[model samples]
Target: MKNKLAIIGGGASGLIAAIAAARNNPSLPVTLFERNTRVGKKILVTGNGRCNLTNTDLTEYHYHGEDVGFVSVALSSFGLEKTLEFFADIGLLTKAEGNEIYPYSLQAGTVLDLLRAECDKRSVEILCDQYITSLKKINNQFIINDIAFDSVIVACGGKASPHLGTDGSSYQLLTDFGHTLTELYPVITQIKTETDYVKQLKGIKIEAVAEIVAANLTRTCIGEVLFTEYGLSGPAILDLSRIAATNTQNSPVIHIDTMPEYSRDEITAILTKKANKQNGTLEELLTGILNKRLGQVLLKYAGFDLKYEISLLSYKEIKKISAAIKQFSFKVTGVKGFQNAPVTAGGIRTKDFNNTTMESKLCPGLYATGEILDIDGDCGGWNLQWAWSSGYLAGKSAAEKLKNGDKND
Candidate 1:
């Protein structure tokens, strides 16, 4: 007799688990439940519709957790090599742009469609709009939505993006089943600033470096900086926002180096040479060096006379301008919240599940995978890779356990 399996949540993790379990046990009955009308809602929005499937170089260091060793085991079992092969086997050609990997077709919809078609070919039952209100262990069967299954895999995602179907509701469901959950927060989102300069610099973008200065820890990232009406955003600012979101509450201060490639001394040397040779106004001289709007804003902040001749500018004034450009600081009031975050920072505690099989330690015949676990990766393709690897392990493990009639207890 074939074992029956149920996977909850039809997002990336849930869909992957359904396909993996069905593929592993062809004779077994596999059914996937999704709260939304369709599956892969979040997967459709990844990488601005390109879907960064996985990273070429995956390591435990990209994730945040108490037990680093556990993630190491999961990564080692299904790392970048396995992930590449899995996607390629599914008929999706992958290409690497720097460290991030995207489909050769460069369409997120292609990845989602391929996965959906594969599930259909395997004859896996996909139940849409079937929200699992609760789960109960009666006799030896796990009951969900009044349907009994030999084993259940909870691939429901975390609280990061609600519109995509993972709104942290799975946390409450798993907790009811005696699973431990961690404090939930937003990750890979923009930060709000308390300073008024943000308004003046709104919509201005420049290539710069942002540094987060906590009590004892400081981290820096160099990329494009976007000045939003609320505060700062863009890839570089989003990366630093994680540190501020985790450590500071009220409002953390971040220093932005408008020019990271050149030192203050080097900039000053160029400025001195240009100012000595040209009789142009300060604003005109600065226009060639920085954005017109940004240069004006910086000059206003530094209390410099923009209309003055470049040759007449004092040494003290130049030093002040140079310092502001090197150490321009702003206060980060808060993050944009989970609705705008790319991924949830926390979820089910790792200690509550077996690292090898993703089986719940407290509840037998019940397993958790994907974002439901406390493990989360950075902005690139780490989270999706986690979904594929963890979901595959849980689906295969649960199917094997049910096939052998093994006692989960």
Candidate 2:
């Protein structure tokens, strides 16, 4: 008898899993169930709609979780080459910007459309708005809402972007099946800080080095930093947010180096020279060096009067001003939560599942993949790569098991 495969959650992993299963075993009937109005709704928001497909620097260093190295087996099994090849086989033309990969069309919708079309071509049944709340296993066969299946793959995603339909419900489903979850946190999100000045600097974007200081550890990232009313956002903050989210109790502080190009002494010397050369106000001293408002705020923060004459400023005052600009620190309060997070930091533990095949070691015929697993990658298309790799492995492995009539495991 030919086996039937049931895949839960029609997001990135589930969609690719359906395609992989159907291709692995032509006789196996694949059914994809989604809770949202349609599959791949979350894909539309990834990479700001550009959908970063994958990265050339695909390694365990870019990913974070309890056992960051747990991703090795899956990535080695279906690494970046296989992921790009899979997309290319499905007619996806891709382009790379340095290490980041995106579709040639540069539209996330194109990626989704091609994935959905391939699933259709493979005759994978896609049932939209079909939310599976529970699963039952009887004699090694899984049943979802009275429908029996030889194997099941849960790709329900994580708690991030709840509106897109994966609100961390899959954790409970796995819990019912004797699986345990790690402490969940929101990553790739904006951070909230306890500073009133950020309100005044709202909408101001600048390129700087953002560092997180907590637990006696320092993590540094360089990119754009956008000041919001509550705190900070942008590529740099988003990357540093993982540390803030994980180390909230350690009183994490974010130190932004607004002027990364120049040393504190160099900036002080430049300011001293400007103060000696120009008879302008203190604000004019930093006129072309930094944003007018930011300069004013820094002057005030450095205990300097904005209306003070620049030529009359002393060298000691100049050094203080440079210090303030180089190490602007904020006490991190918390993150924006899962709703605003791009990816969740934790999920079902990896030890419960086999890394090579993405199958549950405890429950033989059950599998889990994507953000639903406790493996979350960094920004720049790393998370999606995990989704694709793990999903494909789960799908292909499940099909292989069914082809061998190992359903009664």
Candidate 3:
């Protein structure tokens, strides 16, 4: 009898794993199980529905995990070039914006449709609404809800977006197989600060540099920073929020540079000139330079009354205002949690799985991949890249092992 392969979770990694396994071994039967009503439900929401396919900067530097270097083998096996080619072969055209890549149609649905089409042509059986809760290993063959399979691959993702079908429930199955998990944290989420000033500046959006100092590691990102009632959100904050989420013990602090284009000295000189001319009240001094409300808040935070005349401001006061603008710091209390997080930071420890094959070192014929494996990437399409890379490696390796008739350890 021919071997059968079972893949749990029909997310990005599971879908790609089924395709790779079925495509590599035509005779092998591959079944993909999804808890959701359909597969790729999470794909529809990525990149704001545009579906960021991959990134040009596909390096190990962007990925984080217990053993971040473990990704090198899988990435080297199937990198961006192969990913693009595979998508193209399945009839999906792609476009690139700077370092990020997306579907030419600019619709995430298009990408999902193409992947499903490829799986269909490869005869990969897709079973939806199969909420697999546990697996049994009897005589080296895995049993999923009483169904026997020669090999099993778990790609059920993490707890980042619980509503999207990956609620991190499948982690228990791996733990049942003698695997361990690392401390989990939500990443790519907004930062909740301990300040009342942000509440007054709510709804204000500005291009600024956001820097977070945590665990003695400093990370900075320059983009749009949106002041929310809860705290801060936007591209810049989300990019650096990982550090804050992971380093809660070290007391993370985020500093925003409202005017990145101007140095502290330049801002001081400009403010001094305006004050020397007696341009307007302290409230009106930064009207043209910043949002009126944001400027007012900054001045107030620097201990200046809005009714105070700019001409009465001393050199020391001017320096203080400039310092506030250049380094507006806030104490980071926490993040928005997994519900708002784009991806989870920690997961199953990578040491238990072979990086080249993504197979379990403890349990032969069992494997884990994607966000569930403790390897998460930065915001720029790197997570999906890892899913594809690791999934491809796991599927291909599983198929090869079965083909070789390798006895289970």
Candidate 4:
């Protein structure tokens, strides 16, 4: 086992990395260590169990990092097309919803099963419920709890969703080797606000453009944004959470454009028509236009009495209503934190590793991939794609070095 490869974390990246290494080298041993009771635990719950495997729209805009270009090599090596081909080769057919990709079976378990079966076929050993306490390289031997391997891949993920086995304790492993990590924060998560609108409008779903108005940047995403007791949660909101996390040092502002399709004049015309055609009250004017509770909250947010007839509302009031519809602002208190965050915003700095191979510049024979790296993608399927790409490079790169016996050059 002296030439064997050890991969920490049996999550998305770790599993794929192990498979990639074992399949390429064949004889070189590749073993994965997962602290959870089972591998792919987080994969099972992704995209609400459908498992968003990849996205149709793959671009730099979907990702965030201090150096976003660090992912170029890995991504270019194995992109979305390669990802689909790999999945198809593994016998897991996929279907696309708009740009988002998922298993044709519509079950995350299907994807997981296929991945696990493929890894098994490749002679990859999966050790679950195996917590690696300490990681160190001694006498050219990569050691985890005294067990040694020729190369090690760190894919233990970040401090998001501790229940899924990313307890953040694994970060110490890299820091122990003198790796520099950026300030970690919960991103791709829910945003808490100071407005009572979400509370009164709870359980209502509205299609809107959720915006994060930060110190110097204003990012927006258009999708279904759900109102909750605490704040906003949904696809659009989750995407904007990255901006929120990056600007958390200062109080950020959230603006939701509920009626992105309409202009201010259009809203004014529509409201006037509703008043003249049906003698509609304020609530009635927005009856079909918005969710009932959402309309009322917007009315209140615009400083209108709900019972007032739309006909009685002055032009000034109408303009305010239009502004409220177009720009419902919420003062962001903070993010939902790591426990509730789907992914983390920051991690091991990208400059510390080679993007093409994911090998740590600080520590030779050691590689980092997936959520452990600084690269994080927005909600959709970018994150999973990152896992697959980086994992592939890490495993393949590590295995090649192990086989040729020319590692860390």
Candidate 5:
């Protein structure tokens, strides 16, 4: 009789892990268990349903963790070319938008469909809504709800978007088995600031430079910035959120350059040149130069009297307004939280696993992959790539071990 291989969760990692296992070892019986009624609920919402599958510019610099270098092993295992080839093998062609890769069909559901079809074709058992709240390892057999499996892969994900099925429910499984889970925080999410200025400028979007200053480190990301009733969001915010989330104890401050195109002196010169009250109100001075609402907010915050005509600005006020345009700083109060976060920052510590195989160092025949592991990447397709890369290694290694006749302890 063949021993059964059990995989927990059915997200990106579990799905691909199942495929890799079944495809690599056709004789092995692979079973995936998901608590949700369906799998890939989180994948459906990735990249706004367009599903940024993987990044073309694959590198370790894009990822974050206690040791970002840990991802190199897994990423190099599947690699970018192999990942794209794997997707193509499934009959789903992809297109590259800049460095981000998306399906040719441009629907997240299509990616999920291909993965599910492959699982079905390979006969990988998928048990949906069969959420076993807990499990026990008895003699190298994972006893879950009374059924035993020779091997187990825990890819149940971290505590991001709990509604999609992960509430850190399985984190305890690792801890129970002697794995340490670091602090987890919602990453790649919107940030809230300590200012009422956002209230009036809500819904305004613009191309600006978002900079985060924390722990003696300053990083900048240039992209679209969205002003929300609570604070800031959009590409710029999402890109810098991980850094902010990781350094929250340091009280990170976010600074936005409303006019990144111009230097401080250049802006001051422009203000001096346009300082003509005869033209219109102070608000009118910034017309056509910035978002109407954003310009008004900046003008008001610059300590200039709104009633003052554009041409009547004093030398002191002109310099102050120019400085404000170049650097609109906001104290980051906090992130939008896990509910709004697309993924988490910290999870099961990487030191506890063999980076080469993603198997737990504490347990034999017990593996982990995806966000559940202490690996996260930038807002683009990096996280998904990590999932694919790590899953490939885990599935391949687990099946190979089984085929090599590693007996159940």
Candidate 6:
């Protein structure tokens, strides 16, 4: 008799795993279950509908976890090159924008449609709206939603976007099955500040570098920073918000350098020259150089008169203003919750699963992958790459083990 396999969660990772498993053994029965009436709701919204399918640069530095060695193994086994090849083989051409890879058609729906079509072509069964409330090892078979299978793979994602159907319900279910989970938190989220400067600068966008220093590490990211009524957002701010949100000590302070490429002395010299040539007020001189409201606020914070002419300013005052502009700092009071987060920071601990196959070390015939695992990558397509790589390995490995009649308990 052919072995029966069941995959829970019908998102990106679950669908990939089902397709891969069926491809390995066409006669084996593979069933996919999703809680929502439809699958791939999250995939449709990724990359603003363009779907950053994967990152061409898949490096260890882009991911975070307690078990770095385990993650390294997984990446080496199925890296970015392999992912590109796999999709191309399935008739989905991909293109790279900077470091992010997207479908050639530039529509996320194309990727989703191809995967769904592949599943159909392989005769994989998909059952939507089948919410799996529990999982148990009955005798020797795995049980999910009262259905028994010889093996099961859990691909339920994290709780970052609740509307995407990954509301973190799998964490409790896995814990009940003797798996350990790290304290979950929001990653790639926006930060909120106590000051009202954000409201004043709302709708203004600028390029800046955001630096976050913690007890043991300091990181920096350079990108577009956007002002919202609540606080700071955009790529640069979200990159550092994860660290700030996870720190349990004092609230994290972020330093923003609006002029990242220029030195403080260089900026000062330019400002002095412009002020001397124009004979204009501080506010007037900096009006077009920076955001008008931000310039006024910085001048106020530095105890400089916005109406003062450049020639009237003392050398010491000029130095102080330059320093403030170079090292603008703010304390992050809190981070936006999972509702706005791009990914969850924690999930099933890596210790419970084999990094090679994503199979449960504690429970044979059980596996976990995707955001359900503790592994989370940085913003640029790393998380989706993890989903594809892990899903491929898990599905193929499970099928091979069952085909060989290897049932070690």
Q: Which model scores highest in lDDT?
A: 3
Model 5 error, position 367 (Å):
0.1
lDDT (C-alpha) at residue 330 in model 6: 74
Model 6, residue 145: distance off in Å is 3.0
Which residue pairs clash within candidate 3?
none
Candidate 1's residue-wise lDDT over 1-409, tens digit each? 4568999888787787788788777878999999999989889989999999888778886787656456776677777887788788889998999999999999999999989998998888999998887988888788888888888889889998888887787787789877777777798799887757878889999999998776776778888889989999998887777677887753568899998888998878777777777886777767778888888888777777778778888777787788888888888777889989988877888888888988888888788888888888887898898898888888778877876778656
Query: Which candidate, 2 or 4, has the higher lDDT?
Result: 2
For all candidates in order, the CA lDDT equals: 0.83, 0.91, 0.92, 0.88, 0.89, 0.84
lDDT of 2 by residue, 1-409 (tens): 5689999999999999999999999889999999988999999888999999899999899999888888998899889999999999999999999899999999999999999999999999999989899898997689987988989999999998898997887788788989999999999899999767788789999999999999887889998999999999999999888889889889999999999999999998888888888986887778898998888888887888888988777788888999999998899999998988889998999988888889998888899999998999999999999999999999999999899887546
Worst 10 residues of 6 by lDDT: 68-77
- Arrange candidates by lDDT, highest first: which order? 3, 2, 5, 4, 6, 1
TM-score of 2: 0.98
Score candidate 1 by TM-score against the native. Answer: 0.96
Candidates 3 and 5 compared by TM-score, better number: 3
List per-candidate RMSD values in Å. 1.6, 1.1, 0.9, 1.7, 1.3, 1.5
Backbone collisions counted per model? 0, 0, 0, 0, 4, 0
Backbone clash pairs in model 5 (N, Cα, C under 3 Å; residues 3+ apart or in different chains), count: 4
Candidate 4 residue lDDT tens string, 54-93: 9988887788888998988888898998889989999988
Q: Which digits, one per residue and each the tens of the lDDT, describe model 5 over residues 287-347? A: 7778887888998888777788766668888889988998898888888899878898889
Native-vs-model 5 lDDT? 0.89
Evaluated at residue 282, the lDDT of candidate 4 is 76
The better-scoring model by TM-score among 1 and 2 is: 2
Off by over 4 Å in 4: 277-283, 307-311, 407-409
Q: Against the hidden reference, what TM-scores do the models get? A: 0.96, 0.98, 0.99, 0.95, 0.97, 0.96
